[model samples]
Target chain A: MKWIPIILIVGLLAPFSLNTHAEEKSSEWVKVKGMVCEVCAYGIRKSLMKEPEVQDVEVRIKEHKVKIVYKDPKKSLDRVKLAQILEDAGYALEGEKP
Target chain B: MLRLGFFILALLGTSQISVAHPVIFKGGIELQGETQKKDSAFSTTYTFSPYWAVAAQYYEMREPSMSPLGRTFEASTVQINHLLKRWWNEGSQGNIYLGAGAGVFAPQGLPSEFLARGEVNADWESTTLYVAARYIYLHPDFSEDVDFKKLRVGFAPYVLEQEGLNSWFILEWRQMNTEKAEVTPLLRFFFRSVLFELGSSLDGDFKFNFMIHY
Candidate 1:
């Protein structure tokens, strides 16, 4: 009766309302050293993928940069910590974050 | 000959190709094949962890005159390698590896003997230059211990400096124990993650090596 229209309106609006708090993470590029071959790149990709906060990681061979996409802003993706990760994985950190 | 063929078949099992590379990352599969005038060898390597890898190989010598095994024989081996150390110098990346392996060597109509394998490798590479050396020692119950030495110097005339195709010119020297050494001039090309090399030994033996990783 009178309430049917109101119920339809709420249903249509509910789907849009729940997504308001969803956040996106930005991609960051980190420079790395000792990436002379694909083996080095594979090592980087494998290690980075293991981080629960990492969404996607790409290795740029020529530039020696790794593009990382984090899970969210709540998770910390400190550049220094990233340097340590790569260093431990056999890649040397050559320059500051680019 | 039949035993050799069966041994190779057992090694291949279901695979079509075989492997070689100085470096193998953890959790990768490598297939390798090597052929000489009268002998052929096939091998596979699996890197199980960041510091460990396991390899299996089957080798057959077709010519008894060329083989030191006293007769034509076939051998199968399984070896393990570990990454001992890796260092970066300026912009050049280098690594050193050491590993040991043991297997069984069987001569036709003869008892199978235990075989031992040992390897040491080092390599350094930049965008345009690559240098590497490797030593392998194999001692079988049936023959004199064999020592293999290899050295390679390569230069990339065209340094793409990006994720594309890079080409290199390589000169390689290989010696086995006191036998005559063979010099090879080679061309190496890398596209993405796969590397391929083609060369001819000075004695006119064609050689090819290919590598890839997941």
Candidate 2:
């Protein structure tokens, strides 16, 4: 019976720990020009995903923007690399979200 | 009527190469093919830069000849495509390209002749609307020269999400040299890096085309 309370306390604290860890992850939304179709978005996503630092990518065609999630919060993709990727995908990076 | 059908089929077979943009993303590769009765064309392209690409294409057409029999014409060419201009709008993009090449053209059982080709292509597209035009010229040393022109307009019935399948209804107009124009209504579908088109001309001829990017 005494072990029941210990188990409950650990279970309650695990959710908090996971939440704190998730908070450490980082994401950035960048503006990209000339994304007129889904094919354009696909190309950008395919190229960005090949980078080890990229965890996920979301494209907004109407807004001409892309949200990039990083695997490590402290280590982000450099601006030069980001520009090169977009250039290879036939797009121009217009900088980060305002 | 049969002669016209054969001519249209031959034109449609070679038309697929002009349907998509010639230049793709840097280091990208594309494969495209189209087929109809007695005619077919295939091409492979490599994009070395954002504005330049090289492609090799093979086209075959079986058409009626003056000798009471049909003759097959085959052409193979290596072409370089250049993106001359591009425009980016708020929700649309436009591009113009020029291409030139030299190859061999031969009719079955005939000596091959040197062939030279040139093309001008332009297009503008947004999420909901699309428009394009192209002109192609072919000159062979031993055969009559040929001119081909095409125009296309399309519209999407609904907006497609990033991960969803995209569909469009397109109408195409084509003319070969001084021949009568042919109109075709096409259904286009694209998912990710692959695209396919199915259509039938008003003359009851069928067409199918597909493209893949890697």
Candidate 3:
């Protein structure tokens, strides 16, 4: 009866530990905003091509955002670098974290 | 006399009055001829559509080289047709409609013509043109030597498109009653809310047709 509490605690902590370790291994993603038309969406997709680790990039005009899926977990795409490229092309990028 | 009888036959076999309500009705004229002797003729139609429609037509012919009727003869007729396929829109252009209807005929228009005719037709559309092939059963009221069955084909092209303030061209072709073909080319003028056609057929036959639409 005393071991029951210990088993419950171990079962609950196991999932949290696995999740924390996965978060450590996988790079965090920040969806860049500001896409209103086909041209704006294509511009963001073109800028994403410079990142070698970017596995795929998709821009949703309805939500005005771009999702950058990356293959490498150790290295994340720099948002500041992407924001500068967007600024040069007459657009504002937001919700990006270093 | 044989020609007039056949015109009535075509009308009775084709005109069915199931869809004749007072508000919307469709009608038109089709005449065919070439040179001087007009060979064949048929048309005026109203369709409630695939479920219901009625059509009427006329046919006349005179061959001086074959029949002893000189070069002057005429047969005018009116027939009602019911469509085999129903509920099709009556005003849509470029659709071939197949149907059957029956109507009566009074054979007294042009002298030396006799016969009341009934017919069924395959009416179809080709781009801006409408064509029909009809099989007419003829019954002569007077005892004159005319054939019992007359096969006819008719064509009318480009019924729409107003060109240059109501001036447009129409081409019509028909083979009727006997095995003779007639081709008529006409120019239509729409003025004062009325349509008028001036043309000549292959047999040196010339005439004018007029109609008014409300």
Candidate number achieving the greatest DockQ relative to the actual structure: 2
Tens digit of per-residue lDDT, candidate 3, span A1-98? 99999999999899988876544223343444433233334445555656687777765543445667778765555657766655433244565321
- DockQ (C-alpha) of model 1? 0.22
Candidate 2: clashing pairs of residues: none
Candidate 1, position B179, lDDT: 62
lDDT of the structure predicted as candidate 3: 0.42
lDDT of 2 by residue, A13-57 (tens): 999988765545488988887787777887889889988989999
List pairs with backbone clashes in candidate 1: B18-B31, B18-B32, B19-B31, B19-B32
Global lDDT of model 2:
0.77
Model 3, stretches more than 4 Å misplaced? A1-98, B1-78, B86-115, B122-128, B132-137, B141-167, B190-193
Question: After best superposition, candidate 1 residue B55: deviation in angstroms?
Answer: 2.0
DockQ of each: 0.22, 0.37, 0.01
Displacement of residue B44 (Cα, Å) in model 3 is 8.7
- List TM-score per model, in order: 0.76, 0.81, 0.36
Ranking by lDDT: 2, 1, 3
Question: Per-prediction TM-score of chain B?
Answer: 0.83, 0.87, 0.45
Candidate 1: RMSD to truth = 9.0
Q: Which residue runs does candidate 1 get wrong by more than 4 Å? A: A1-25, A50-52, A71-73, A76-89, A95-98, B1-23
- Tell me candidate 2's fraction of native contacts, as a decimal between 0 and 1: 0.55
CA shift of A62, model 2, Å: 3.5
